[model samples]
Target: MSLFAGMAMDEESVKAGKLQIANYKLGENVHLFGGAFYLCYQKGLINWLTDWNPDVLIMEANPRYIATPSAVKWMHARGRKVIGWGLGAPPSNSPHFLQKWGKRQRGVFLSQFDALISYSQRGADEYAALGFPREKIFVAHNSVAPAPTFQVSRPKFHEKPSIIFVGRLQARKRVNWLIRACAEMGSKPRLVIVGDGPEREKLELLANEIYPATEFVGAKHGAELTPYFAEADLFVLPGTGGLAVQEAMAHGLPVIVAKGDGTQDDLVRAGNGWQIPPEDYGALVQVTREALSDASRVGRMGEESLRIVTEEINIEKMVASFVRALNSLRY
Candidate 1:
């Protein structure tokens, strides 16, 4: 069972086999006493497991949620295979005490599972480093569906360049860094900001003050996001979570992203995109300048990006990898 039953399932996944999804009635997440708390009813859990009679169970490895651990133990007791999927590494530069404690706790908790699936190769390596058996660790790289094809021709370098950012406008996203970097450019590109959050007004105010060419297009999805990808010369996400990086590359746009979560390590490469040190404004600015300096280089990098997504990291490959991992546990 999964927490996000309404999540979009690709046609490839549907055709792979019969699939069932379930969701917990998520309760309000409260933060107090220096920790987070939330509620999930276990009322129907036993019944659901009984009815489904699943051969394997996959769950997120967030230890904060008591329900997951309880469910894991329940399923294991019944002789069913259980898998914990997660970002295997702690947050970069996490507190020493928290890191040490978390490592110990996760080692104990995750050891109960039949196998552990990491979101990236880096994550799998981390699981191994923590003493999890290497053979039991699997990498099912995160991916997104390819964007709809846009018929537009590539923009020339001298033509007005478009630099786009697509994600939640939150503090951790550090979108303000993109705005500040745009301000430093000699020839400013048209900056398109997609998705909205609490930081919208603040970001809008900063954009108006320094980078007037900035356009805030609000949140977009599916085909609605195609044009932004089609019109852009480059894509930038100065914070974490890079599912958008894969989508942009599928649309033939090269990327610039911050280094943090290992997601970028799997998606971004030398020819396809560049990874900036997290929160390093100077390095961000310098890389942006050099990348935009040559228009032809941008076009070439975009081609490379498309090739990588099409051949190496598209949803088809991701689904195939998942199917192989799941089948391996069946026997």
Candidate 2:
């Protein structure tokens, strides 16, 4: 498929093998209103659209993208189909009036699309709740590149199990909470923190003060990062983001992730791992202890983790969902 992006490939994303590089790039991405709104423009967009003339156009679901509305109008004029792809609608549980207004605006924007493809079932459900036709909404569970092989055997529980957290050290990640939770444990696991970010220094200081043995391995990707997942008995993401959880499962480690983006609902299930209440310290510690408490059970759970990634969700399934959504539409 021909793809376009607003940014060039970065060393980190390329090395991590996460993002698929675009065939062409648009103008520099502009963020307005303190980065809440995103807009990208390209003088060549119309030229590309005319030359390619795709039967279907799948655009970002975010209403804030300044070019999307015009693009949608362009496609509709040609009687071509358009699909809205995104994480989900605005937070359904948010009590803020602004969020409610945002959700309404999203609904109005998304109503223009011929079909919707969400990253998770939770997202699909949200779209339906927003009055999008349920039949038109498809779920493509978010994924990472699967491991070359699922050879990492289930880890045996030890006096101190190895717990790995892979992702940027950002405030929203809540790595500090992970440290505090481990510190309170009677038998703390060996915490290996992979990745570096703005919060790395503050996190390192917090780790030293409480969980002194926590390892900060800077950032490793591709082959360098695999060993960390292979060696760890468990993977924990205390804050938002679930991409690393998919990688951990592919390597046969049961995960413990806080309720983050709605994707967690699909990734962390009863069979594969635990999804603790977000920002709940007591829940994190309790779940970690229980997961590590049984060596054999952990192994079985790891196997389940592998099964989920292989049989249920991956890049292959994600692509298939896109194809299915396109096939279901009349173009």
Give lDDT tens digits, candidate 2, residues 152-171: 65547645688899998888
Query: What is the lDDT, from 0 to 100, of the residue 296 in candidate 2?
Result: 86
In model 1, the runs with Cα more than 4 Å from the true position are: 1-52, 91-102, 146-153, 156-158
Q: How many clashing pairs per prediction, in order? A: 0, 0
Report the lDDT tens digits of candidate 1 across residue range 102-213: 7888788778777888888898888888788988888877886843354445765537778999987787788999999999998888899998877899999999999988
Name the top TM-score candidate. Answer: 2
Q: Which candidate wins on lDDT? A: 2
Worst 10 contiguous positions by lDDT, candidate 1? 6-15
Question: How well does candidate 2 match the true structure in TM-score terms?
Answer: 0.87
